[model samples]
Target: MSQQPYAPRPQDPRPRGGTPPSGAPPYPRHRPPRPPATSDLRLLLRLTVASFVLAVLGGAVGLLAAPGQLTGVPVGPAFDTFVLVGSLVLGFGVTAGLYALVYFPLREQRQWAWILGIALASMALLSTLANAALLLVGPAGASPGLVTGALKAVVDVAWLVVAVRPGVRAALR
Candidate 1:
């Protein structure tokens, strides 16, 4: 009987590059290719961070604007109290939403980020629209408000578009 010569086993760390090293066992034919790692999540990250900061600032502003003195008002005590409570509620809600929707989800790369971001953007757009309408229709001297609202609406629209892109979705996933 004749004995065959021994050959060293080949080692290939990356099998996705096609073809295993010589002398290595044949690679599995049915293995699916892995999705490539996304390399462009900077915009999303920046948006998330900015949203967080804005949420905090908004909450602070709401708290500060809670109307401590109700002087010469036509509304009753209940209405004034309601206004205070509503402002506090809205402020805290915005802060919480930003944390839950944008900050945490973005950090974890969760799909909730997309949904929450869209909701946030839509809300922002609507709020800006309302502001613009008020500025245009309200008494006089609101040009600054109109300009700010328009700018905010534009930013909101941009955020909505970027958040819904296929690349952003893939990256989040």
Candidate 2:
């Protein structure tokens, strides 16, 4: 006896990347159907995931740059904690979070997302370069932050190269 392949029931929850029913509400973005992420796009996504690690490290770096000492003023523990928290929220944490935002629309073939991604990558490359340069030019020996910053700059450069790939640009367009 031959068995038939099973079909999904009408009420089944739609799987990701699956088409919606004809009568479903239209999306606001008005984007055309896009192909699955290109390898370069996938690489970009991976970089965003990696950025979270950088964000945490960035927060630690804030402790090293404590505001109390830099400003030459006495401060309470509460303020010190506040500064570190602010560092995490305002610095790489936000930058990394925004990268994920760019990923979704870029995967959906949004031109604006593509543009934003390019801008984001360029800024990241510049920031990491500056951070690494500061550490290298300082009197202090190579520290963990320096090594990590240098590596992050390398990754940012690679991300920018992938972001400009013909296939990646075409998909977003």
Candidate 3:
């Protein structure tokens, strides 16, 4: 029928000296996860570059494959060669150069590069959506061009979405 002094019991979850119980992590369990590692940033850079490259490559494929369908003139080997070379230049050459412009500076954590990369990503997303809208309005239904345009739009959106993530943005900063 008597009350004792209130005190932390032996089973108190909060360990002394701010240390966690045995087998627990050094940080609090509720602590937010650390920023992405350098390797992760590198991977993200590669992924974003790859997504754009793939989008360009897919465009090159569509140009070569479907443009001929749009033309009434007979296709020739020379025409095919021209299309291939042009796509290779625009897709592989130009895209590579643009990405290189962003990639190296971004790797070095340049603030301008971060801004430029975001701007470029936004342009790419806009271009994809515009192209998709064009394809949807065009006479072709479910054509390879339309399909590829849709695919590119998906990729571009994904790239921009991931590029804006806290980890990716922090890496750039």
**The CA-based lDDT of model 1 is what?**
0.63
Weakest lDDT window of 10 consecutive positions for candidate 1: 1-10
Candidate 2: 10-residue stretch with minimal lDDT: 65-74
TM-score of each: 0.54, 0.66, 0.59
What stretches of model 1 exceed 4 Å from their correct place? 1-40, 51-93
Q: lDDT of model 3 at residue 79?
A: 87
Among residues 3 or more apart in sequence or in different chains, the pairs in candidate 1 whose N, CA or C atoms overlap within 3 Å are none
Question: What TM-score does model 1 achieve against the real structure?
Answer: 0.54
For model 2 the TM-score comes to: 0.66
Model 3, poorest ten-residue lDDT window?
1-10
Candidate 1's residue-wise lDDT over 43-119, tens digit each? Answer: 76666565555545544543444334455476898987787779778877756766566757665666677787778
lDDT of 3: 0.68
| Cα TM-score of candidate 3 | 0.59
The CA root-mean-square deviation of candidate 3, after full C-alpha superposition on the true structure, stands at: 15.1
lDDT (Cα atoms) of all candidates against the true structure: 0.63, 0.68, 0.68
The alpha-carbon lDDT assigned to residue 153 of candidate 3 equals 66
Clashing pairs in 3: none
